[model samples]
Target: MRPTAAAFRPLTHRITTGAAITHVHNSSVPQARGILTLKDHVYFAKATARGRGRSGAVKSNGDCPLELKMATPKIIGGTGDGHNPEQLFGMGYASCFLGSLQLMASRMDKKHVAEDAKVHPNVFLGHPDDPTLEGFGLRVEITVEGCEDDDVITAAHEYCAYSRMLKHGANVRVTKA
Candidate 1:
């Protein structure tokens, strides 16, 4: 069964109170939550990367028409001439969240407000300040313009796949081919 905004209930109340928000905002690996698998994927996007570290290049597969040269951001000690992974992630999340917000809004009969809503997403890179954790980490912040309804925002947070993955870690398997 698809989860509704009520599935994330109490979150709506929490948003209003500004206390005890459940979503994790840190770079630490997420704790396991519920699991649901779809019988079929709606779509699959593939991309390839070559070169070294942040100085590489990424190109989308035949399915997508995208190509970008990766560059380490100045904040992380490199020339910020090209795009970085964070920008891509931020853009993806913003797009997904905006859709989620609009979806929930339409369900709540507030589609008019969401029709012009804008999502501001920020992906920050840092140490994540965990002694046990190594390497770089990411922090995300999203702001939705034109919608202040706690229910819509909370529902969108719950609905967004990116947010869900960050909150409840996805099953990731790395195997050499």
Candidate 2:
């Protein structure tokens, strides 16, 4: 069974209580019960899918870059003409990680070193080793170009939200609509 949000806390978080106000966007707001998070975001987006499974299409609710036509790979009995979820995940991870790496390098006084950093992410889908879970599982390997310093990389990993989520796990829930 999936653990409830109230019961599951990240290993890195220390729970806080009470109406402690935080300044965000020049406004004071009460801290959430479990932990303070980005309830208010600088950017927001929504996507919806249409049509059959992997053969479907996905588009953003508002202005978006592309209206994707998804297709399963030939190895899985698909036409393989279009994109897949793995590709999307890799793109998001790479972009986010690259931004983090660049920021890290700048903070470390090595701005020139990672000015052209590129994050390459390899996302692999395979059967889960855990028996209770479903068949599909994902693993990722990220390589950063233009900077190879372990300290910079380590700092970036810590600062990056995507990196933290991959390493520490996340709370997700699905409900029937």
Question: What are the clash counts of all predictions, listed in order?
Answer: 0, 0
Quality of model 2 by C-alpha lDDT: 0.63
Q: Which ten residues in a row have the lowest lDDT in candidate 1?
A: 1-10
| Model 1 lDDT tens row, 1-177 | 111111122233232111224443321333335654557887878888888888789999775589998998887788888899989998998899899999999999988868888888777776746577677677666767777777788778878887776654555667896
Per-prediction TM-score? 0.79, 0.73
lDDT per residue (tens digit) for residues 43-97 in model 2: 7677777878878887876665568899998988999988998899889878887
Instruction: In candidate 2, list every pair of residues with a backbone clash.
Output: none
